[model samples]
Target chain A: MLELGPIFRALLRNKIGAILIAVQIAFTMAIIVNAVFIIYDRSQQTKRPSGIDEANTFYINSSGFGDDFDIKGTITRDLEAIRALPGVIDAVQINAIPISGSGWSMGLQTEAGAEHDGQGVAVYMVDEHGIKALDLELLAGENFAKSDIRWRGPAGSKWPAKVIVTEAMAKRLFPELSYSEAVGKTVYINNDEPMIITGIIDKLQAPWVGWDNLDNAMLSPEKMEFQSTRYLIRTVPGMRDQLMKTVEELLAENKSRVIDGMRSIDYVRERSYRGNTAMIKILTTVIVTLTVVTSLGIVGLASFSVNRRKKQIGIRRALGATKASILRYFMVENFLISASGVVLGAALTIALNMLLVSALSIPPLDWFYIPAGMLVLCLVGQAAVFGPAKKATEIAPATATRTV
Target chain B: MLTMTNVKKVFRTDLVETHALRDFNLQVDEGEFVAVTGPSGSGKTTFLNIAGMLETFNEGTYQLDGEDVSHLNDNQRSKLRNEKIGFIFQSYNLIPDLSLFDNVDVPLRYRGFDAKERKKRIEESLDIVGLANRMKHLPSQLSGGQQQRVAIARALAGNPRFLLADEPTGNLDSAMAQSVMELLKEINKKGTTIVMVTHDPQLATQATRNIFVKDGQVSEINDVVAMHVANG
Candidate 1:
């Protein structure tokens, strides 16, 4: 242990410089802790299974141009052609793709005329082959039968009588019941239309990646033919590129409609969470830049201090202090400053995390990150001061005899 | 005891090489108080620095307390200095931030003494300096004479075998310089060997013997009273 009393007294003589360094370290600690938390959260989100065969699947968007074009007929023919193509396993027309950040949502309640708005649930509209195309597992109950499929066109609008809800959605609606018990139960949509739950999927995320309720989703057996129709086509492994080109050409050959877009589900998911990925990148850059700048700041300050105290160092050397003692003096001085900054940073980290939790709805930062951040700062502080401390130890004791 | 034979020190630069000390020889028995006097640039300070082991001589054999120091590395030299030699500077080069007690405690701390031993040495040294009541005062808060006495106390704290003082009273007035010289004489009476370098003739006369240097070589050595009568 060093003599901290003298070290602190020395720092008090240059309180401004020492305080500035401490404050810099505090802010650096705050940013690094929160950035790590956010980065970990976003990367975990990207790693989640989308309940769809994202690697080998692609989607094509088609919109009818003229009134004479038969929209329903074109969708039916397009899906059939896509399914029959080489390397194509299964194809289904969906109202919206999973993890696309764009989908339809409705409120579901256990009873009609309930005063509350009920739980918001993501709604996916597909046919009998939807589960197979998305590779979703049926954990309980049964898949939708072919006869139960309903076609809803522009001429008429009606809700599906049967729906397949994810296990998360089932728990939200009927928390007290088992997954099997949730099946065959009636849930009212818009507090009017009654639909029976036919199946329960193990897991299916919502379109929005960071939503608190991403797993609350349901699938309706309804054939939707909108102005712009979307077809999810799953192909054999390593055949997405070939299948996308073939399907795009096949749809282009028909002049009745225009191909708005065609991309693999992997690309779609990347685009949907582009904001989240960008945030991660930006936070990482800021963290790296802050660490560098803070370290450089410490280096600059220590170098300046060494230059200013050269005579004092010479005197100490003349008084029989070894080179290692002088070196440790400066290092201990820097550690005290860094340790002070870390304490201040812990409080600042809590304050900043509270703001983030309230404004962005992110979870509170984990407790372990604080000590982890402090360790990093301590190491950085010591490394930064080493160069200047070494310089101080080289001062010859003969310097004390000189007038200067 | 201290001994040096044919000591040489050179200061080198890009354009010139200056011989600060050449063929310097000196020997002082234990408990002897010797004063070195010289004109400016005559290398009296260089001699004192070498004697204190603060600087290395390029060519010489030096022995302090029966140990050869000519081949010791920096760490060994520092340990020897801490244990056996004390240094006093013209400017009273006490660390300004530390109190008088802490300033005196520096060499004792370097000696690896425990806290109780260090405290005992510090208090005893301070008491010997006649400023025992001012232990908590910083160097900046004291007069030049007081600061120089504190430096002396610091040198005495380690109970060194010898003390090397480079113009210890150069910055003080006549009264202060006389008091400091008297203190040195008292310390020497207690059997601590002391070597002081100074230009003040009156103060130089107080030591047991005086050596005069000219052009990096010792010109003459004489007893203080005999030199006074010879100059007359």
Candidate 2:
């Protein structure tokens, strides 16, 4: 502790250089820590919007010539062939898939002759097996069956406005209605007569890294009469890709419906979040590089400053300073300067984070960056001190006797 | 005790090689006060530096307190110098920003002594130099004589084997120089070997013995060395 006074005094003797080094440290830390925070935010959001049971699901898009323009039967035949493939998992053909390239938007009103005040939620006209293939749970009603098509109108029928809604959308449609109350109530979509809200399915969270994902409402194909360009498939473990290929070939062989290439639900979800994830990667790289450079600069400048004090170090040596002691003296001085810089940087990162929030759609600060910034600074100080402190220790006491 | 026999130091540059000491020899036992004097570039400073283990000679064995320091590393030399040598320079070399007490405390801190022990030694040594009450003063605040005294206090705090001074009184006025000389004589009487190098013939006369070097070689001249000391 007694040794600290002189080391500290020596560092303080050059206040400008010390403060500048600290500033460099702080600046790099701000970028580095925030970059980490941004990556964490990306991960959370990527996993946030997923809805499908990613492990069990795959999506097949069929887009080509159908028999004299009958895309639905063409789609249905391909779906059947895919289901029959080896490692056969249950599969279904649906008119509309969630987050599909095509979806219809219309007003959904909950009472008779209502003026269609609110727009309808995304509605997938699916079969019983499709819901099961998706692992969707019915919150207040039974799952769809192939038999339900007899009770409902044609696919894409101007239904009396009833469709499933997410738990969140249900709350929005009826402020006081509980999830149970929203069920069995008649809602009008596109100002047509009201359709009953059959069942609410849970919202989906997509994966961070693809294209086969849906996160909204599903309805019986009997209610919505219009068919869609999407086909959803579920295959047994490891067979989904092969089955997808077979389905495409079948669609081509039948000449009734066109078959699109195969992709898992994982692919769609990954695609959904790729933009943000890539951004995070780029930003983190930039911040890390900046931090490393800043730390190196601090170390280099500190070494130079300590070198300039060689004669003083020599005087101290002749005054009975052990070489190790002198080495420590220089090292401690560098650490002190670095610590001050880190503190300043932490404060600045907070301030800069506020500015970033307003300027762009950036994620919030993450937890990992704080320690990473400090570690970078420490390594910088230790590395830089090697040169200057070694030079400092090598100063011969004989220098003190000579005329400087 | 300090002893050197056949001490040879050669300085070499890329273009020129110069031998500063050619077969030099000197010996001083415990409590001996010896002064080294010579004309400009006479190797007085080099010999004194070698004696203090601050510099090593090229081709001779120099012993300080019965140890051969010829092959020791820098750290080893630093430790030996710290534990056994006191240095007083013409410039005083007090860290201007520090208080007298802190200056005295500097070397002791490097010795790895505890705070209490270092403080006690600093106080005692400051008192011995009659600067106990002024320990709080800065070197810049003190007169030249007082600053040199603080430098001595700092050196003495190490309890060194000997004091190697390069023109200890060179920067002082006549009275201040006399006072510093008296302090050195008193310090020598207390059993610390003192080897002083000086250009001042008058001040050089106060040592118990004097050695004159001409052209990197020492020659003992009994009558001439005495006359030089006696005239002052």
Candidate 3:
């Protein structure tokens, strides 16, 4: 171990450059630690299971071109033709799929016109085949029977009295009861319409994955015939792409209706989280740039110090200090500076994480990242100072002593 | 004790090759205080550097303390230097950021001495230079004479077999120079060999022996007291 007193004294003599590099290290640590945490969180979120067969599924949105055409009849015919496609397994018309970032959301209340605001929940309208088509597991309850299915108009004039809810939504409405007990419970929508929960799914996510309550979703047995209708079709394994084109062409044959959009659920999900992916890219770029800049700063200051102390180094060499000793002196000095920076950076990291937590409601940064960040910065600092320290060792005691 | 036989040193640039030391030969016995004097660019400093093992000769043999060091690698030479040789410079060469004690501690640290031993040597060396109370003072805080004394303390801290001082008092006043000379004489009396290079003839007369260099070669050697008696 080196004697740190002399190194500290030397650094104190040149405090300005040392402080600047320290501050750079501190900010780099804070930004990188937090950025990495957020990126990891977002990446995990994107990979979360939507409780559906996403790989084998695609969605088609259609709208009739003319008013004289029967919207319900046209949707029925298009769904029939799509279901008959060779590779298609099952098809159902849904208002939206999870992770699309846009859908219908309403509140759920145990009693109508309660004084307190109700818990908000995403509302998905599907038919009797909606559960099987989306591959949702029925947990502690039965699937919706055909007699429970009903047609709901655009204004929701025809509302379903029976509804299927995810286990998360069930727990939210009746937190005092178990999953089985929450079944057959009455829930009010929009503070007026009463609906009874008839089935419970193990898991289903809301359209917006960033929502505070991502899993609070409910399924209604409504044959929704909107001006623009979305059909969620699940295909046999490894057959989605081939069937997507065939289905689109068959749906477009009517000529009275146009295929507004046709995309795999995977593509829709990716588009939904595009903002997060872009954020990761940008944060990664900033991290790389900051690390490079901080390293260069350390190299620049260390080189300057080495150049200014050439005579001193020569004197030390002449005094029987080996080349390794001279090199170690400089390295020890840099380590002192880097250690100071890391200590300050650890505090800064916590402060920055607290601010982000309060402002953005993100989870607090994990404590492990602090030491991990410090380790990286210290390694970078040492690596950056190595070149200048090596140069100091090359100073000849004879030549430098003669410089006077 | 030090010996050099037909040592040749050449400095080369793209356009010229300069022979800094050509067929240089010298030897100094143990416990002798020798002063070397020469005109500017006469290679006295070059010879001192080679003698200290701070520079390697292009050709020839050098033995320090009866060890053949002519073809030793850098690390081996460094080990030998650390074990046996100490150096002092014209400018004192004290690190400005270090206290006097730290300055003395440098070579001891390189020598891998324990802290207690290093502290004892540092204190004793500083007391020899009469700066024991000022161990905490930085080099920049000391006067030229005081700083040079601290340099001497640093050189003595390792208990080197011999000292190679190049113009040890070159940057001091006459009174300071005389004081430093007395200190060197006292150290020499204790049986430590010293080879000092200086341009002052008065200081040269104080040494037991003196050598003059010209054009990278020793032109003459004299016993200063004998020469004075012979002149009388």
List model 2 lDDT by residue over A136-162, tens digit each: 666776565555553232433445233
TM-score preference between candidates 1 and 2, better one? 1
Q: Which stretches of candidate 3 lie over 4 Å from their true place?
A: A65-68, A109-113, A157-159, A174-181, A192-194, B228-232
lDDT of 1 by residue, A1-404 (tens): 37677778768867899999999999999988899899998888888888888999999998888767777788788878888998998999988888887898888888877675677888888888888888899999899988888888767656888989999999999999998799999988887678899899988888877677889899989887677788999999999998899889998999877899888889988898788899999999999999999999999999999898888888888888899999999999999999999999999988999999999887899899899989899889999999999999999988889987
Backbone clash pairs in model 1 (N, Cα, C under 3 Å; residues 3+ apart or in different chains), count: 0
Summarize candidate 2's per-residue lDDT along B88-132 as a digit string, tens digits: 988898876577888898888878789889889999999999999
- Candidate 1: tens digits of C-alpha lDDT, residues B106-134: 88877889889989999999999999999
- B1-232 per-residue lDDT for model 3 (tens digits): 7888998999999999988888888899999999999998889889988888889889988989998898888778887887898788888888888889888998888888989999999999999999999998888888999999998988888888998888999999999999999999999999889999999988998998999988888889998768878987
Candidate 1: residue A28 Cα off by (Å) = 2.2
User: What number of backbone clashes does candidate 3 have, counting pairs of residues 3 or more apart or in separate chains?
Assistant: 0
Q: Per model, how much of the real contact set is kept?
A: 0.61, 0.62, 0.64
Q: Could you tell me the fnat of model 2?
A: 0.62
- Measured by lDDT, the strongest candidate is 1
TM-score of each: 0.95, 0.78, 0.95
